[model samples]
Target: MWSRSDAPRIMIVRLSAIGDSILTLPVLNALRDHFPHARLSWLIADYCAPIVRGHESLDELVEVNRGWLKSPRTIKQVRRRLHDMRLDVTIDVQGLAKSALPAWLSGAKRRIGFSRADREGREFSTWLNNELVHPSALHVVDRNLGLLKPLGIDNPTVRFDVPEHPSEIKAASDFIESRTLRQGFVVLNINAAWLSKRWTMERFAQVAKYLADRYGLASVLPWGNEREREDAERVAAKVPSHAMVLPKFSLTQLGSLFRRARLFVGSDTGPLHLASAVGTRCIGLYGRAVDRSGVYGPQGIVICHNHTSSDDAMRRNKDNDAMRLISVDEVCQAC
Candidate 1:
């Protein structure tokens, strides 16, 4: 962050959620490029740590669970660790009250964060960061990179160093052989963290059939929980010739599988971003969220049906009629 000879201690504070965690990888890559000698670290949530766990760019990965601040013992432990790091700067990429508190706790002289114009960077975060950046880009990845202008870095090369472990590779290969999916397949991630973002099974079935008949690509459905598992099975049962379901696996393993798939068709969810990060062909389905949060690269094809909905109206936790607007014919044509 200073002289070429100096190796500044920098930490990135991104609290939680899967998709956002994947998007932050580009910022980490940029920072590493700018300061080759810098000791770079990331403060991530426990759930999302695996996404960036073994990245070549990161020197440290400090993971904490939700509501850790509420516990006096946990706070003491985290603060002690932050103090020992002797951080030169802490960037608040999360831009929330929870994310802001970590930056304040870091006690870094050059605490950088986004301006209030960014919806996420409101009054609470503004009070914490010592330096504020007014981002010019619309995409979240570009916006995160905009924070690096203070360090004399601009328009840095966009890259995601998603780890491909040996064990995960073997697991993915074994699954592929077991399922007889050697003829190449496309991932249909029908489940989403937001109900509003999830397209109907019938629509997914139609897309699955089209992929099978038109492209000779079978559909692979991956689920997170038991409820999703049942839904995936139901879809597979209906489209037995075209669709199949993947068993329980970790995020890392899923990345390995996605790397081998012909295409990824999913809503604005973690799996879609993960697929994008691993350099897979992604057809991102958007409704509640904007296309700006779509897949990161040229290989991505965004099918957005959102017309008049506002960000405040399409909350992730609530169900909306927006996703239904994305018809089967539209997805088939995109395919």
Candidate 2:
């Protein structure tokens, strides 16, 4: 294992989940700041690989197909790829068994990972690593950055620069043109991965309509999975005639679309975080979750609530205790 004195080829292993991957960019930047000329590569999931494809700080991006972990041929291919890369230091930022295998197989002299107490997963992943990054009372973004401390890198100002795809820029421009939207527009992303976290479709529709009537702002909705699309459609049905429901877009395309938006309002989801990363004003709806560690607002107003247990049972009660308590008036005031 290379000591702190030696600058070695490094690989950062942070796989899937778009929001989490976006948060890792600061860590990548810190590593570059510490080792300006060191060979640095990122092992990212195929789904989010496009977001960091042309990152200036990275030497190379190694794609890891999470689906392939279950297949022997895919594992063999990944193993061969790691063998060819000859990484000197492997850091497992995902802290999951799935992320650990790549680090173990990378044949790096120094394998670093979160300790068992800090991370939840198969314990063996930590056993395989040569070093452990102990847990501290830090944000996930800072924790990811802390992993670089072993390599002599310290806390650095977070900066995420996602490139704009030419095609996506054209598409967003065409979308605005098709709608005859001349002024600034607001992009409202209403869908989230968890059902517990999402507000009612009717509620989102009401918000969209309110924006159109009061703000005179054009609104667009972006959906990820099929269920999210259905939710968007439901919201679109109730929106003003001018508000549009946009089609699915790649991560890069989404970044481009977000950059052009005047405001972003969404559930605790990836695209919301992406918008926040780009310094867009955001109003995030968080339920049954902590906003401090995650779902934080980005240099803008944020309204967070924890849904009461009554809200969880589908009882249709308006308790207004936690997240459900966040009123439409509060959200509009932020916007």
Candidate 3:
């Protein structure tokens, strides 16, 4: 029912989680392609905004601090800001009470979201949207794109237009130059946000050592926080000859690193998704998400323990038996 002559003020709402935010990039791409003349805005968390801050396809960004919901005063501030935007259409790809509440408050004429059966917090959020879409069994990227059907967008392409910051690229270049790292060095990320998803430090060392000895490749370990830095240091200590632990970097700097790397080896996490988006070949280790099926891009491969059952894969803990069952040789061979 929408026409090319109409220019609706559009707002997309997908907030938090590094990986999920990156996956929502395709939805932005589709809307940009179809409604080039419209004013398109993204309501994202403050932390993940840098990933797409300078993207060419985006018109505006609304950053919501993580703790804003805790204070009534701040909540009113956010509500007032969103209401002032006068959005004609609002798409809630996040599909939660937190996201739904804001979408509802925006007072958009065409509010779209996943159906009650397809989305979580169904009982709480079912009434927030004027239009509901029943999604198919597809990758989260495509599932997010499905929300565009009501706006007359279909069969959209998967594209990640992650912007490059010149300063960040210079930092990445300087780091590589200082280390004397050659082209085609592998990036090994040792931490996952979830405890059940991390492969052991010893196994990571073994893989790094093997890559060094067999393929003459150096391995760099990039950590996000103090705990990850400690783990990366332990791994680097074992293979001191070929492994280097990187200092903490911003999101854009990590993207710069991934763009220069020959390949990426990591658990199912935000960095792995970032690597795939930047056109790096990736070997993702899996436990509960073993059959990551369509989640990866063309050059990305997933390795998992053959014996793990589907129902038992996603348990939460520091030491996952299924993840531990995967051998270093399996990961090395896949790389």
Candidate 4:
């Protein structure tokens, strides 16, 4: 273990995937409490950096844009950039080569990361870390906090200070008002990164119809891409009540909408996790490909399909039988 200093410079590496990035919140909070006066920095990918960009607990955010380090010249540039930080300790929560390489290059004296058994690696990232953390079967958030144990932060508390935006909140409020929707609106996200996790549009329409008829709730379907927008449109067309397809909004605006929503229903995706982070009630529709362990919060009501032994098929997004097992009534009952 590294000896404690008055103001040790620390860097945390977690890159990509909105859900994984959000799960790293507790780690950041725990580090803040353990070393209140220490200089804390985070190395993150450009895409998902917006969520934690202007965070109050962070001293700096080192952004790595897409395809920056594919070439040897760029890799050296990245190495030189991190070397300039003079990081004393580097904690890598993302157990991947892409994440580990940068942390190793940061010139940190104590490079702490996951054990080899924790995750797969082609880049042999585990060899780079001076310290290894054996992971438990805990939720991803708890597991992230576990990385702090080596740094003398034993009792890591879970805290996610989601950066607030009043302007975005107002914009969300205005958009909802324009749709003549008060607070009791259910935001439906009908998309996922994998096809296996995405529920049928027919099922989403039925759920929307049921919620509208039973609870007098309007449904707002938010889409990220053209395919999702098309799916949202299809669901809206089929629903019997106030279901509308929402235009694209920034991540901050989406957070504001989730905060105002009475309920959030979606497949196992980033928005479902985002809604949970913002203290919104969410029913996460998950498939067998999704890891239900440690991902859901207390406010999240997860309804996952039974386990299947088709990992290969699920990876190819060829098997959606797991998602099919979740009935519309089951989702309504949870809501």
The best candidate by lDDT is 1
Model 3 alpha-carbon drift over 4 Å, by segment = 118-123, 290-295, 306-314, 317-319
lDDT string, candidate 4, 1-335, tens digits: 44445678899899877888887877887888778888899999899998898888899999888787777887888789788889999998888788888988888989988887644232577888878888874467777787888888876767888777788888898898898887579998988868777788898998898888889999999988888888889889997466998878988789889999999998767788788888899888877634523246678777876754344334555656778989999999998
Candidate 2 residues 1-335, lDDT tens each? 33434566889888987888888888777777767777889999998898788888898998867688889998999889887988988989888788888899889988888887644334477777878878564467777777776776666777777666679899878877877776878888877666655766666777777888888887898887898788778778787573678887777888887888888998667888789887788887776534333544346555666533332245333322355666787787777
Instruction: Score residue 199 of candidate 4 by CA lDDT.
Output: 88
Full-model lDDT, candidate 3: 0.83
Question: What do the candidate models score in CA lDDT, each in turn?
Answer: 0.88, 0.76, 0.83, 0.81
lDDT score for residue 144 of model 1: 89
* lDDT of model 4 at position 242: 63
* Ranking of all predicted structures according to lDDT, beginning with the best and ending with the worst: 1, 3, 4, 2
TM-score of every prediction relative to native: 0.96, 0.88, 0.94, 0.93
Tens digits of lDDT, candidate 1, 1-335: 48656799999999778999999999899988888899999998899999999899999999999879899899889988998899999999888778888888987889899888847586599899989999678788998899999988899999998998999999999999998889899999999867778889988988899999999889999999999999999999889999998989899999999999999999888999999999999998887557358678899998876644356434755674788888898888877
**lDDT score for residue 244 of model 2:** 77
Choose 2 or 3, whichever is better by lDDT: 3
Sort by TM-score, best first.
1, 3, 4, 2
In candidate 2, list every pair of residues with a backbone clash. 305-322, 305-323, 306-322, 306-323, 307-323
